[model samples]
Target: MAEWIYEDGIGEARAALIEDGVIVAAEIEADDDGIAAGTIAEGRLVKITVPGRRGLVRLDGGEEVQIEPLPRGVTEGGRLVVEIRRAALPEPGRAKLALARQASPEAGIAQGPTLIERLHASGDAVRRLMAHEADALEAAGWSELLEEARTGEVAFPGGGLRLSLTPAMTLIDVDGWLDPAALSIAGAEAAARMIVRHGIGGSIGIDLPTAGSKAARQAAAEAVDTIVPQPFERTAVNGFGFLQIVRRRLRASLPERLQGDPLGSAARALLRRAERTPGSGMRTISSHPGVIGRIADRPDWQAELARRIGAPIALRPDARLAISGGHVDAENP
Candidate 1:
């Protein structure tokens, strides 16, 4: 049976779905950041892009969503109610939000169980962790996963694949190795695991070396189906060894979230460091200036981390440090 491990930190809340003692899914949320998605709000229509394609709706709290299927009879500067289907990812500025449905003006704040809560309510045996489950998350080289997710360059057992993000789809280029059939099979399996590990979804295109037979191509495509989760559509490998797959996208993929912000990923890395450290008094995570700035901005997160670790948490901004390179050290109280 699968067990759910949940950790409620001072500033961050994390949940992991562990099946057979291996973590299959993980989620994290910060207290300082407002819930990104699954919220309904009242807003005012600000602008309409074209006649019926998309419209900008500003919520009462000043957030805005580019609502699609443009609401009927809605004009400029009109009262609008919408449910935020997708939350804006954390970026330099406002994130583009996708609205799902029209809501009534009387709808209050969207309420729903958190990731961990939802998992518990699903009738699974849930276990609450007194501390962060870094060990479980660290399985199979955590650093490598984070780095790969950030770079979108992944290597298979005998080959490699580079994933490129386009506005329309994620294009993957597979190379290395001599056997086309073996390479295609390897690429398909690796890509499927990477997609799940990196939380990749939506449209995907894989370009493999031209195979000799349609049977070989079909076999490769089947490998992907066997590994990847359901509710996704895939096309058979073409003559040129091209396969297109589409999956439902819910949240920002790890690659998409950390593409431009290495320090953001670094900050989370430091949190994992704190989690792994055994003894702690005043735990200080010295990081790059940008990373420090982000952590400092979230006092609630700092407090939460401190409380969870039973120590004072300090974030030191060292301009000399690289974003991805930092040390988590403990000081005597």
Candidate 2:
């Protein structure tokens, strides 16, 4: 047997079911003739059964609610779409309230705890404190950094090479002031090390101080490989004698976190708006958090419908109002 507790919020309904000493489902709550606590039925996307009562709820992707039960005093076939949030609360408060109401109100009033008091009361407060601290530690693991490119001629500590960076590519121009010394292989090695350590990704062009002989260019290329341990299939000195570096994306780069594609979120709005129009042939393209938020908070969505249909729109949460045109693909988000 199962027990279902129904809660109606500003625009939704949420139900919680407890069974076998555990909460089976408490997130999505729906009210339909076919739903109860013990058995899963068709149209019942989510279900759970308790010792005596059963519960079921529907979800509309994110937060926008499409359908819910009529509030008390509002008869069936009523019009109104409500959104609700459901979660577990401590049971001690329910018991205390029951006992107080049963006992003499005047006598029990001073003895019983407040509703908020019961919700927060815990047998082990230390555990709750430790969990909060652990959450902070988990959040600290994520890290990121951004490096700005040099704008003008920048001097190296040894005054032998120079590097410049722009939005398109990084330019490494060498002066070779060291007595035309057979291309200091060690200096090229040091430059390569800095590039790898800085985590530079994308195209890099290296100018090797205008080497007099092909052997000097080859020596500089070999030195770069020795200093940088990156796996290379082949390092071919191009016609211009510049080393074209194609470094693999070594880490979970910064831009990956900053940019992303879009997604959908309003199944209810799509369904209702399409239903409101006649022969408009509208369909739910996608459902996303942003669309759901707009649906829940916005006072009216008929304007959105009208925009699509090129005419005035009619929207009624009341079941009596029939929908005519659009199709709603309600996702289980």
Q: Which candidate is the best by lDDT?
A: 1
Candidate 1 has which clashing residue pairs, if any?
A: 10-304, 11-304, 36-87
How many clashes does each candidate structure show, in the order listed? 3, 26
lDDT of 1 by residue, 22-61 (tens): 5555555544344356677778889887678788887787
Once fitted onto the true fold, the runs of candidate 1 whose alpha carbons sit more than 4 angstroms away are: 1-4, 9-11, 16-25, 30-36, 90-94, 103-109, 121-126, 132-134
Q: How far is candidate 2 from the true structure (C-alpha RMSD, Å)?
A: 25.8
Tens-digit lDDT track of model 2 for 241-303? 567675643221122111110111123324333433234333343334444434445444445
Q: Model 2 segments beyond 4 Å from truth?
A: 1-161, 166-168, 181-187, 238-240, 250-333
Model 1 TM-score, all chains together: 0.85
Q: Lowest summed-lDDT stretch of 10 residues in model 2?
A: 95-104
